[model samples]
Target: MTRKKGPKIVVIGGGTGLPVILKELHQRNAEITAIVTVADDGGSSGIIRDYVNVVPPGDIRNVMVALSDIAPEFKDIFQYRFRSQDKFLAGHAIGNLIIAALSEMRGGIDPAIRELSEMLQVEGHVYPASAQPLVLHAKFTDGTLLAGEAEITAAHKDIKEVWVGNNPWSENKKPHAVPEALQAIEEADEIILGPGSLFTSILPNLMIEDIGRAVLKAKAEIVYICNIMTQKGETINFTDAEHVRTLNRHLGQNFVDTVLVNTEIVPESYMDFNRYDEVSKQVVHDFKGLREQGARVISDNFLLLRDGGAFHDGQKVVDELMNVCSNPIKKRD
Candidate 1:
């Protein structure tokens, strides 16, 4: 039986949220291009970036593992974390190390990432939003300026504005877009933003000037997969409407054409996780306000906490996105 090729889809985001979407989308015959965020400043990525002076490869590693057409053992090996009193291997992922070594050998991030993708046999292409090591500078509501991803995330302060550093670390003379990423956006039949961290995972990609321009220029239907629960430090009290507003502020006024939100009520029994309680679990979709913003809402059972942590039901979300793409409507401008 021959499977029909699905739509060409470009997903832009980073972290765990993106891999979940990529894994589900790969199940379909869609041509997937993942534009990953590279602003990470924590964990193994931070260690490597500080020591080796390269783009943080953690998100790229996650996306590769998610899209690889390999055995579960392979994925586990890539994701394996070493636990030791040894300072070097303490909390690093094996995949991160592989990426770091490749980057070092290849002279930069672009070639290293390309080699890793080929080695993984990834079903989809993954590109960094920028080859540069970006410092996420934020102007807090209290008028204090915070620099570096770690400092901004830890400050726990309300961000008024954010921008990339004056001198970003890409090899390109200008902090340019990944040509492949931009091409994917231009040719995409649909573009999906994430159910990921609002400020960190999703918005960081948009901070790239060329990527932002490509998104605005793309003719494909733009969709946002709203997060099920608010992020603790980043999106503290953000409602679904507020989330859209924040993204729109970054991408522009009439950016997203549709929003996929979770309307499924989570079972109380599934809410016993300490992490859920810490983040104040609750659905935050604002259907009325979403419509008011000229974006229609597609509500569904997106919440699934299998191992006692909140997560999107990847297959369910993918199914809904496919349905929406098949039945396109003229977006309200």
Candidate 2:
């Protein structure tokens, strides 16, 4: 694919952080394609996935809302979760149920999402990392193994490496990337990773054999929007470069061309523990370490203090993303 009206940007990851970036990107009219994680096995997504036997719709549903140009009432209806009093439907979002049904009816998640995208008037394409649901397996430094995304985080052990495999229901038994996702990676002018979990949300998408291989071989400026605050169970005391190192070690190459880092200080006094119980501290910086790993670092005051917690300012990061796209780099070693 060649350049059209705008830059073709492929954003990868799962969790709440993904939609933040996508929402801002939609405003830019950049040709966007989101390759979302399907390895969730927690909360409403886990329950829906188990019973529906389809990929969890929580993350994908949010991504839809981010890029969709529908009315607010429609968005509300789709995102509405059932009350605890609503027995069978309790905790399930209407969109999740709809996605599950569509996936079942359409024979796969790939086609289901494309159908929904058209209906929602989505500004961009959204692809599940795989057709069938992927089971994320984590190997801890303690030599312990966990099979589910929820379990890996709950264990709070140092993650050594992670990989993906098929659920028992999958006939292939080996995970496969949806072809559209691979093609997006191949054709993208810029590929963005994260603003989400290091080991779970982002890595799970990359762990798929074909997606990882495609990203490694692609001629795009691969940027990692490093998380602003350290997650308690994941990156307790990690430097920005440690995050890059972890990513490089996993892919077995220095594929990251640029890393966007937030330099603003989050005052310890400003953080509300009740609101952000999972947050540890701000991720410290190590410019030397990042340079050693071969990524050009772009640091800025990209912080947004909201609801008594810290997060990346989506516009600030996206501005930098567009700049990187303007002058693309392919700094792989």
Candidate 3:
């Protein structure tokens, strides 16, 4: 008996969400490409970018750790954060500093990431949307402008619009879109968007013109893993349909073909830990609204951290993704 090869998949997102999905896909023996957002401006990544002048490496680091074949000890080393009263070593990870050093020595981010990937023995390729450092700019509903990932995340303002900086950093240099990324999209049977923070994690990558164009032109099934709960400041009152609507607003109406939502009820105790009662309660499945936007909703036991709080069931999410890839449904025009 022979085993069939798994489908190729390109996952576009940043932060914890992309890594979670990537880890699951790797377990399934799927060919994976993670297109990570490089606009991060917080914590260890921020320190490296501000002082060393490099692409924020936090998201990339997360992806590497998620897809790595190394033992837990190595993984722990990659994720270790240093704390000190001294400003120099405070709040920075050894990995972030290493990536910064590599970026400096290699004279570019692509080669630096490649070097790290080799050391980590990662299972899949990870690429930033662009090589240069980019900023995320958001216009509030009141016309106030918020710039940078940190500011936008902390603004506590309703966003009216969002786009990447149009400065020289975002200029014509192609950032050498990873060959693996483009190839994955071109050959992919399916693409998964997220179960991550919508504005900061997911959309930031899509905001890159080249990446968005690739997603638009790719001849593959696109699936969106909706967030289990609304993010505090970023997505205050967004529902499942609203998440899809916002994605369409950015990626285009036809960019996403399916949405996997969590339908399993979570225990009330879990909700307390998640502080669900304090924030927007639940993101109800708006089947009608989703269908209206030409996206099908696949509801299941996607809540993993369920006590009362919702989360993506990693295994179930991967299962649904595999099923969709194996039997793709044609999109309506």
Please tell me which predicted candidate would have the highest lDDT against the true structure: 2
lDDT of 2 at 3: 23
Residue-level lDDT of model 3, residues 127-185, one tens digit each, is 87767777778988888998888888787788766777533445554433455567667
What order do you get sorting by lDDT, best first?
2, 1, 3
Candidate 3 runs further than 4 Å off: 1-5, 84-87, 166-180, 272-280, 306-310, 331-333
TM-score of structure candidate 1:
0.92
- Which prediction has more favorable TM-score, 1 or 3? 1
Residue pairs that clash (backbone atoms under 3 angstroms), model 2: none
Please give, for residues 192-248, the per-residue lDDT of candidate 1 as tens digits. 999787787788888888888888888888999998877655777777888888888
Number of clashes recorded per candidate: 1, 0, 6
Worst 10 residues of 2 by lDDT: 1-10
Candidates by TM-score, descending order: 2, 1, 3
* Better-scoring candidate (lDDT), 1 or 3: 1
* Shift in Å, residue 135, candidate 2: 0.9
TM-score of each: 0.92, 0.96, 0.90
Local accuracy by lDDT, each model:
0.81, 0.90, 0.78
* Error in Å for residue 292 of model 3: 0.8
Give residue 119's error in model 1 in angstroms. 1.5
Worst 10 residues of 3 by lDDT: 166-175
Q: Clashes in model 3: which pairs?
A: 267-307, 267-308, 270-308, 271-308, 271-309, 302-313
